[model samples]
Target chain A: MPEGSMGISNIATCTAPVNIAVIKYWGKRNEELILPINSSLSVTLHQDQLKTTTTIATSRSFQEDRIWLNGKEEDINHPRLQSCLREIRRLARKRRSDGDPGLDSTGLSHKVHICSVNNFPTAAGLASSAAGFACLVHTLARVFGIEAELSAIARQGSGSACRSMYGGFVQWIMGHQDDGKDSLAQQVEPETHWPELRILVLVASAERKPIGSTSGMHTSVETSCLLKHRAEAVVPVRMDGMIEAVQRKDFPAFAELTMKDSNQFHATCLDTYPPIFYLNNVSHQIINLVHQYNNYYGETRVAYTFDAGPNAVIFTLQEHVSEFIQVVRHFFPPETNDGHDFMFPCVVLKAGPGPCVVDDPTQHLLGTDGWPKKTE
Target chain B: MPEGSMGISNIATCTAPVNIAVIKYWGKRNEELILPINSSLSVTLHQDQLKTTTTIATSRSFQEDRIWLNGKEEDINHPRLQSCLREIRRLARKRRSDGDPGLDSTGLSHKVHICSVNNFPTAAGLASSAAGFACLVHTLARVFGIEAELSAIARQGSGSACRSMYGGFVQWIMGHQDDGKDSLAQQVEPETHWPELRILVLVASAERKPIGSTSGMHTSVETSCLLKHRAEAVVPVRMDGMIEAVQRKDFPAFAELTMKDSNQFHATCLDTYPPIFYLNNVSHQIINLVHQYNNYYGETRVAYTFDAGPNAVIFTLQEHVSEFIQVVRHFFPPETNDGHDFMFPCVVLKAGPGPCVVDDPTQHLLGTDGWPKKTE
Candidate 1:
């Protein structure tokens, strides 16, 4: 575990929103530093479908700084956990004059305790880690009263995680060279910039993975040169187009690029040594059906993109929601077949304010200390 | 509704394949004749997923030759049905003194009873009409002993109906409209040319549509100018690329073009006025999941396409089917939920022959004559 030699007391918590990559981040330049090979841009999912709530508590009663996640006490000694904790401490600004001696004037020399609970399932490929790491870093900064830009701290955890620090449009700069220092995320635009732009996340199947992003990216980078091209060529172009699309409110351009980039990214994965199969028959059917409908009608009405799992996030204007729902309803009628379930309720979220702390922690997180033990 | 005189006394039954329009035939130059503005392409699905089985009977005991579909006597006077029958009879050959018509003679006149049953649901965007028309033509051809190319006769029913004439990769020729006699389908390559290719059909939902294809296409063409650009600019290039991909056995290229073509076609649909929505969250999620898995692994693993409705037809290399199946299994796990059916076992067909008449018709299609009444 990342340990604490000096004495400290009292704990504080923090929260962060989930993000969906628009200009996807494909390869890595520095795996250890979590530095990206190219810049990536993502839209922060309004803390509903994707969020991470983390709590940090420091007490004299604690013997060491232990970390727990989603009810299970995780070994903080794991290199990833250790690296995240250590990096946060290094950047955290000191609050008082030698108040505890636990954290030095440099802020790097300190001990902290972290307990996090993700609102959604991890390893389901819904950007849970992006939210988790962003939350952890955000909470740590709050605990130490440090303000060194949360993205800077988030960069140390995962490249994409840095983008989750801000709501709406966020871009992660893929920096140059081997030391992996200059890379960090910056806000391009906020969700409020275009409130009419709505997204519907369709959870296709909530299946867990044998390999998580940590190793998946590594395999992808080593075996797949297409991954290299996507990181080097496609993402850069997509990034520029995305920024412009967001700025101009060009739905067609936005829809076209998002769909193309996503298809290309997956194509590169297929170009990898041993192919990966992420999409099922249902996924292809949806894409085909959407394309057919769009062609049949003749324009860009609803645009869709997918992350690691089989779930889909659809981007549509407010006006077209009902028509979209009705067409889908006809094809996927609520017919009960031998023990299988299929339903899609067009979930609409009235764009809310950016991320804010809840009135109370217990009710918000559904348990005590934001780390309730799983009853099941 | 193409009727014969009261003296008909014999019956003939036949089956034909349905062809889905990849480029899609949404606009018609002549609505009365059901002539399309642009050519389309489709693979005739092996009969298991979709096909039309029809029986034609002529009886001296009967009055005017009548028609029955799914065991219910449908309106024989429906204009479209009458048009189809009249056109076929116009070219039908006459019987000799022996009461047998030779294949050499063109079938210019025949008044025969007609009955058809779609193996799958009609008006579900599975192109039941395409198969239905093709079967009607083929059965009449057999009954009249006409030897004209199947495509030539099918065209009289519906423009896209011609493409269902041959198995494997088929292309519809967009002949000059000075005379509408030449537009017909031709086999690009036989099914034997690409034996390694496999198509997986996901019956997402079996619900029928409110808008029939004829009306739907008419509305789309009249209102949506984007459909014009799609037929002219997008489809030509896609057709070229698709043909080349198929010739080279380049799975990735073929898959990419097929998917791209599908998307472009759908984009045009959305561009239509009063935008059409053919895909839902479930469909979108499936698309995302497929792309994610393909991207994660980094290879050209699978290619997917969808028709007018929500059903997805996935084309993949025979080798990677297991991996594809595994990924699909993980996402759409067979589990009970809210009494709504969601998942089913993915069916894989061993390489086999195309449609052949069932030894015992009662066991599969419900009736050897026309069809059984709708159970529900």
Candidate 2:
């Protein structure tokens, strides 16, 4: 530690909402740059129900940078972690050199210790990486007093994390630049754009780590010709259609496109050599139930989309939420023997804002000593 | 009833082997003609293990065309059935017009009674339609005494049935003709070509009827853009690769391609709107086992392919059959409580010949009266 900056510490806490891709991001053109093969769209869920709370503490007394994810210290040397840290520091240096008065010079050179936790169970098949990275970058920015476009930095952490930087509708444009400078997430609409639109996360009973999106998508790019065609021909059109539907608040159109795109993403997964099976029996039954339920109403009342795992993220109007939940419970009866009220727990949320700074001191996950506070 | 030929009944019986596609047939361009969107290749299982036997009886005394499948009467008015019968009769008339004196004129005008039965359990998930249609067409040709390119007739019965027209390895050529006159199945290699290749039908425990190929493929064609790209860009190269592998008797190359194509077919199934779920937990576990087993051996010792259901049709060289079967039995233990030796009954078979006429009188499924004999 530098003697002049001894015992100096700065802390920032923030929470980022989880974003469910409506037009899925599957293949990548540039692995290192995290440049996607096709543009993707997502709806950011309300943070109160589903989010990652990340607290970053920077101290001149700290010997090195570190991170604790959900109470366990993970490898701080992970390549993606380094990428995110490097990009953020680089942006902070540029702002300081450009005579930005608000830039914290001491915190810029200080080592950071990040503590992150999710509100929902990590085993529920919900993707935490997006929210985790988004919250990390957002909190790090606040501590360093650097606030420009941070989504590009989050993109360096995880491809889908870029979309989580914005609330409501967001699109990750697949830029043509070799350097990936133009490839960044842009907001299509704000949180209040569609008030009646609701999102439900159906936590599937089976909890297994799916084939990591990085490796799974890498194989798809290499082996699946169908994926190549899909990236080139199919997704571009769907991205446009989805944006239009969200803009018009056309529930039926948005719901249909969301389901189709999710199905196609999983299709590409299966098309990969040796194939990948993510959705299980419960997932399939849920798909059938949703379609049957929609058919009974003679219109598309509900739509289901699955990510890399079996848990389904459903999109429907506010009016249909109760009925859809009832249908899900009836079909997948809760196991009373296990003392659970639901076979798959349902988390209901609506579109909400992106990462925001936490002002309350009690919510701080890190102590003044630049380490995660012990939980009782 | 026609009094002129009331007492005359010409009966012919034939058996056809069940063919499992390595390169799957999933869509059609011409539904009426049964012209496939993509060419497909299949290995015919040995008749001794899995096959369909059909008896065709032509009698002027019969009031109308009738059919029985597995002892139960089925509507003969089915369009595909009508297409097969009409094509055979049309071909018979053409042969007679060409001054072929041996054509059976009385049998051509007679109303036909068709009876078909599968040797393997229908609940085993083995495709019976391909074999059933092939046997029906082959037996019909014998009774009518017309035998020039009968595969085109079989193709009308089922898109995959055309591949069952020839032995060993067969390819259904997806012709460019709108009329489908040139669409025909060609033999890639006879049953004698690959002597050491073996097949095992893993009869998965779950035995629900799958989405019929006709309806399934129809939806895929309509809804899945990935299916479109696959037919256009993927299968052509795979077909060539598969044919070369079969010719070289290359087990590794053949196995890899077989697994890839099957995965792609199911991938297209998932891409279908209201997405179809063919592979269940058992199917997924079997897939993982096959991959793990091959990985353990450090070579492609076995390969698996699934059609429209959970049952896995595995392919391997003769040297690996016993060990692989042991692996399968160990992983999927037989149901001792149900008195079944194998939970998934394994029927070992080798590549076999096409449909053949049953010359023995006692083998006829229909009695001398031109009616299906009652099952005792």
Best candidate, lDDT-wise? 2
Q: What ranges in model 2 sit over 4 Å off? A: A1-5, A101-104, A336-342, B1-6, B102-104, B335-342, B374-376
DockQ of 1: 0.04
Q: CA lDDT of A101 in candidate 1?
A: 53
Q: Which has the greatest TM-score?
A: 2
Question: In model 1 chain A, which range of ten residues has the least summed lDDT?
Answer: A364-373
* Candidate with the greatest DockQ versus the true structure: 2
> Counting only residues 3 or more apart in sequence or on different chains, how many pairs clash (N, Cα, C under 3 Å) in candidate 1?
56
Over A1-376, each residue of candidate 2 has an lDDT whose tens digit, in order, gives 2234555368889999889899999888999989999999999999888899999988878899999998999999999999989988888898989998765576788899999999877745677889989998999888877868988889989988899999989999988999998889999999999999998888775465568778999999999988999899999999899999999999989999999998999888888977887887778878898899989999998999998888888999899999888888777777542222245546788999999888997889987666788861
lDDT score, candidate 1, position B70: 65
Clashes (N, CA, C under 3 Å) per candidate = 56, 1
When summed lDDT is taken over every stretch of 10 residues in candidate 2 chain B, the lowest stretch is B336-345
DockQ (C-alpha based) per candidate is: 0.04, 0.60
Instruction: Give the TM-score of each candidate.
Output: 0.51, 0.95
